[model samples]
Target chain A: MGFLSEDAVATFVDVLVRLVETAGAVIIFSGCVIAFVRFLVLAVRERRVSSFTRVRLDLGRMLALGLEFQLASDVLRTAVAPTLREIAELAAVAAIRTALNFFLAREIREEREEIARDTAERDTAQRDTAQAAG
Target chain B: MTDAVRDVVALGVVAAGLLSGAAVALVTRAPLAGLQWLLDFLLAAGLLRLGATGTPTALATAAAIVAVRQVAGLGLRRARAALAVPAPEPPAPSP
Candidate 1:
């Protein structure tokens, strides 16, 4: 009859886990769709590598955030299952997701730098052209 | 419900990957960029799949994807350098 009874706790935890995981998936999918639309529009109008890079960068950021949510769900799962096997599974899943997110972060940083360089190059090229013409 | 959601996202990732890959190729005139874009989305799809399932086999496949992606990325960058492709910069020396 108590709110924190075993049945209530199990049901609450299950619902909580599902909610978190669903939120993560929604974030990732929405990010993908937004980036997809932006990429198409920008690709057509600008046809610039920097623009594409920017869109992809935004997508990567979203994916990283979503992964965090998913990893949180994995942790929640561990709370329910304290057995050795479950913990081992959690370790592996968490490790793989962590590694993926790390690489993703690195790639995002690299792309950001590339965008800066590209902008600089464009400015230099324009300046040179103007100087020659003037 | 979980399986359905995962399947849809997985399919969406594939479709996005192909479309974005082609778009990059067409816009940038660089096959390397296209391939890299494709691989990026592929990794996303893999991670999405892994979120629900954590079997040892799934973990191994995920790790393998990361390894392959890194190796292929390095190779592509090197190929760009060797072919004198105008990289935006010197890749910042991979920290």
Candidate 2:
């Protein structure tokens, strides 16, 4: 192959940066979409419709963590070179966020189930007591 | 301003919106069933834009992002409910 000129090198670097930015954005968007779908399904099944209060608290904490991770990634991506460094940061951030979502989902599910069961038991006890008195 | 300062400014703006969203969710008891992902996406976009160039525009952009997310989340939750499948029952234990 012929030697590349300085102008060609600059053009190539610009295109590469654009490509990285596009890819990173797409990855983040798609991953978040999937996580959201999962959250919706889990929340419905868990019957946490009345427990938004708890989730709101959880979200506040989660948002803080998510923000810290995302900001750190942005800082690294902007401050570092070599391109791949930014990609690595993106991957790491996505993975961490996904893991956190999963953990939160599981916790919500367990707590909701416990609440449902307790409500059910209390209702059943009330019914039995009324029947005995009658 | 330097890139570092710009990044910090952006982060602060995005953080403020995020905190506001979280506060709204907590205080208003809005549904969280499908908002987490939307919020995360908004937060990410906000951080990216605000961090890139420090400006008042960044604050407006972040607010718009969160607003869009709130709308999308309501639609997503409804759609999800309509499309839900019945979960299978667990096997019964031995007597």
Candidate 3:
């Protein structure tokens, strides 16, 4: 309807941005906590880099998700642009986040490749052992 | 409200980073690994701070944190690779 005013819409966007950013922070925090626990457990039980890699991989995924959410919030923050300064700030923030996101993605890809290579090596070793034993 | 939440989260993040970093260092016995983990958590904290404050200074700080993390992470990866044991060579063929 025509009932909503411009300030009202701006306020709504502000609220939405805050909600989105908070949600992103919560996701990142919980992911970090989970990864920390996993790291502790793996450290105690296996003490191997392989196990830690999986934990890091999962953590990286979570961070990437959280970063995207925050980036969305950043875009939303300027959805109803008010001033030139605000737009410039948004651009600066977005640029930094985009760069960080790129690196996070690359690290995740590297970890996934490492996990795949490990699995292949393990499977080959198992098959050879089975054949030698039979 | 955001300020309070930011403070609490920042404290929690630092603590988590330290605890996990120590655990990793103990398990791997590698200072580089621990430092890398610590920086990742700190970067998360910086991001959170930026979200809450949305100020230019906060943005700059976040950017700095990310920069340090990338540089440190790369160094740690190289150091670990260098320190890694080489894969065992295949058995020699029959003469």
Candidate 4:
């Protein structure tokens, strides 16, 4: 492709940043919506409130990923010619988002470990039962 | 660096970070603890470079984010470990 002019390049970067930010928001929102819908459907069909942890874990993972994108876009927004005040604002926003992402990640990890442990325990119990029956 | 070059590099880094995140999500079944750290490091480096070129904001932002993440992650890991440890059993009923 032909080279873009300086102004065009700057505008392109600005658009890209906005696009990424929007996409991040969409990902997070859609993740939550989808997870909720899935849970509702399951609950209705099964007549039980199962799979809550799975849904929450999936949603948390999506939110963490989306937050990463949002953070990147925020950083990119100041790439062209950022003023001191803008930088300060960016610092504040980035710090908050980073903290959110960190907690979301930790929660996701804990849930994953819990699920794994449950599965392992179940399998061990089943194996022992089968051996005793045999 | 010139504005065009800088913009290109910044865009490139962001793209790489996104791609890496996606790849990790797709390929890994485990929790993203380790890969997330790598992704954050890459982003911090990219933002630092952007800040060096007259955008001190990017550098400061990156530094603040990384610092918080590291400190919080340490505390979280310790807390998680503590939670995982089984509580000591109470002494047997009095004789």
Q: TM-score of chain A for each candidate?
A: 0.88, 0.42, 0.92, 0.83
lDDT (0 to 1) per candidate: 0.79, 0.48, 0.82, 0.59
Encode model 1's per-residue lDDT on A90-130: one tens digit a residue.
Answer: 88888877777787788789778878988999999999999
**Per-residue lDDT of A1-134 in model 2, one digit per residue for the tens?**
23476566656655554454444433443444444444445444654434433443344344444444444444444433457744564454445445444544554465466457767988999999999999
Model 2: residues with Cα > 4 Å off, grouped in runs: A1-3, A48-134, B1-39, B47-95
True interface contacts retained by model 1? 0.53
Q: Taking the tens digit of each residue's C-alpha lDDT, what string does model 3 give over A49-93?
A: 678778878888888898999999988987887899888888888
- Residue ranges of candidate 1 with Cα displaced over 4 Å: B81-95
Report the number of the highest-DockQ candidate: 3
User: In model 1 chain A, where is the ten-residue run with the lowest total lDDT?
Assistant: A47-56
| Candidate 4: residue B46 lDDT (0-100) | 37
Q: Candidate 3: misplaced stretches above 4 Å?
A: B82-95
Q: Ten-residue segment with the worst summed lDDT in candidate 1 chain B?
A: B84-93
TM-score of each: 0.84, 0.33, 0.86, 0.56
- Could you give candidate 3's per-residue lDDT for residues B14-40 as a string of tens digits? 799888887887788767767777877
Writing each residue's lDDT as its tens digit, candidate 1 over B5-83 gives 7867877887998998988888889788788777777766766677665467866776687678777876876776678
Q: Report the candidate with higher TM-score, 2 versus 4.
A: 4
Candidate 4 docking DockQ: 0.04
lDDT by residue for model 4 over A56-132, one digit each (tens)? Answer: 56766776777888788878877764478867767766776777677668767877997788779889999999999
C-alpha root-mean-square deviation, each candidate = 5.8, 14.3, 4.1, 12.6
